[model samples]
Target: MSCEETQEQVSLLIDAELEEPHQVALFRHLEGCCECRLFFDSMLRFSKAAKRDLEEIRLVADDILPLHGPLPVSVRAAGDGANSLPMHPSGLTGRRSHRRASEDAVGALPDRRSGWGWKRWTGLLAGGWRMPAPVAIGLALVLLVAGALVGTRISTIAGGGGPMGRDGRVVKPTVVVVCSLPEVQVLGSASRL
Candidate 1:
């Protein structure tokens, strides 16, 4: 067997998961190959060190926590309650307390119950409006169609005659010719010398 295959089987053997035949083969390879034997030895040492470290960590964690269970009283409320928010048993503050504080600071604002206007529309946009799947699809289609119409109108107005003209005809390309007889005569005179 190759050293690579032996090393893999060594790991499985350490975990006691390798088959009997594979284990015998791995041992025979380890006996013949010095490098494979060294690799197996190092892996065994690393596995033992890892297990020891994990055990130490588990012991430390067990000592840190109370033997009985978690404390019933809130840790935040254990000290003076002067500046601390009253925490619920589940560790969340009551909504009413938050609402009261906000109301006192900002005072009462005017209620906006009017139909969809700029302010309401902007607020909905800012807050991220969630439409139904069908509504979202329909809106996307409408926007796409409007964008295409706008693009077509802009291209027509710009007079590049893109694709089709306003008359629904394919516009022909226009070419202009320039005469350079003066420069050609200068070149002909130079060539004669």
Candidate 2:
């Protein structure tokens, strides 16, 4: 295999995912090419060092903050108050003594929700959005009504005539004749385009 091909297979080899035939070909190339052999050895060293460092880090992390198992009954029942423990994104809820009350916004709010009505309203919309179901339905209803109103035909007098009485009375026209309209042209729906 060429150098690039050998390098590409190096990861698969490290993971034990390379086929025997390909692994043999790669190993043969590594033995003949001093450059490729050095590259392969360096990669192997890097992998070993990375694993060791990660294990050390994991041990230190466990000692500093062992975020495992179920919460204590008292902390679980404490709710989201200032006195309650704050949870990390990884679900590591700290002890109450580790908490700082001033940093807790919920703890700052008064018992009455009415005091922060505007804030409460906006808070409902803050997270990854999904319009509230009621709001979505109301919007759909408004669009339907608007479409109906816009689609409704505007009424004009029949036979392009004035509102002459069917009883043959020469009465004043309640609706004006469009044919007798002045210089203006009335195109109705055709004008929309």
Candidate 3:
């Protein structure tokens, strides 16, 4: 690979994100090219320095951010009127802003009811993703009773009983057949024939 391509891949190499074959190619190029090797070493140092700085920042932030209360709102000057966007009250960047938004979200919900327990909860969550304890319990009971009834009916049916059986066992019915044949002609008179 060319020095330019190898230099471009420096960051990916430092981060261990380059695939194996490409990494081998880049390694070979870095070994051959003095300028690309220098570039790669410089980038490695820079990446390490950047990561160290970020860790320090995070350590300082962890110590500082929680000690301070919510930040004061910042107002922007309308230099170019079209570009005048108001600065948010959440400290400086995305992480702080997200934290601030989540903190405010609980108190920001609209309360519609006069009752205390339910209303307070609804006010905090906008009544999202909630099931009352009593309702949940009632539903559980309904399911339990339905399941029990179904189980009992299945047991009765599986015990060999038909619909007409009095006990839980099957009752077979009795069947009788009748047969008849044509009789020979009797004597014309009352005498024996």
Candidate 4:
């Protein structure tokens, strides 16, 4: 087989996906061709080195901070106060910790749980409680239906008139008829009437 084909087969063989017949052909070519043999060896070495490096990195990371357990008390305390940890020059570890700190600061307000007031209502809304999707949809539908009904009822009561009167009856607009004439003639006609 050509060197290019042999190289492709070598990759498939490394992945353990090459068929037995292709493997035998590749081995025969590798035995006859020195360049192909060197290519296959280098690929094997590179793969092994990469795997070894990954294992070393995983070990070092586990030693620094365990994956399963809680963080050290020092790390936890460092995140709690305004003082910055020595390891981190900035007072914040990440956006999440910063947000938590801000939330805690806001929650330090005076107690208002004893009475029903605007403060209590706002507190409930800010506490991250969420209405269920179905309930929210139902509420929207109810408001829409009620608004439509009220609008139609008011329009029917008012009819085509300008507006509803104090006694709930439609008030018709007044019609004015104007007659244009010379000023002296209009005065003379009014005097005759």
Residue 12 lDDT in model 2? 85
Write the candidate numbers in order of decreasing TM-score. Answer: 2, 4, 1, 3
Residues 1-193 of candidate 2: C-alpha lDDT, one tens digit per residue = 6788898898789888999989889988888988888888998999999988975665455335633347686654443342334456676544422123223323443334345454555445333234555554554565555445434422332334333456754333232223321112223322211
TM-scores for all predictions: 0.34, 0.36, 0.34, 0.35
Per-residue CA lDDT of model 3 for 1-193, tens digit only, reads 7777888787787877888888888888888899998988888788889988976676556435532235333322221122222334553332444454444335432332334676355334422435555554554465556556556645765785544545544543221212111111222212111
In the range 1-193, model 1's lDDT, one tens digit per residue, is: 8888888888888899999978877888888899999999999999999988975665554335332234445633342132333345554333344444445346433333434655555445334554444544555565556556556646664785545656676554322222232111111111110
Q: Which stretches of candidate 3 lie over 4 Å from their true place?
A: 67-193
lDDT of each: 0.56, 0.55, 0.53, 0.58
**Top of the candidates by TM-score:** 2
Candidate 2: Cα lDDT at 191: 20
| Residues forming the 10-long window of minimal summed lDDT in candidate 1 | 184-193
Flag regions of model 1 displaced more than 4 Å. 66-193
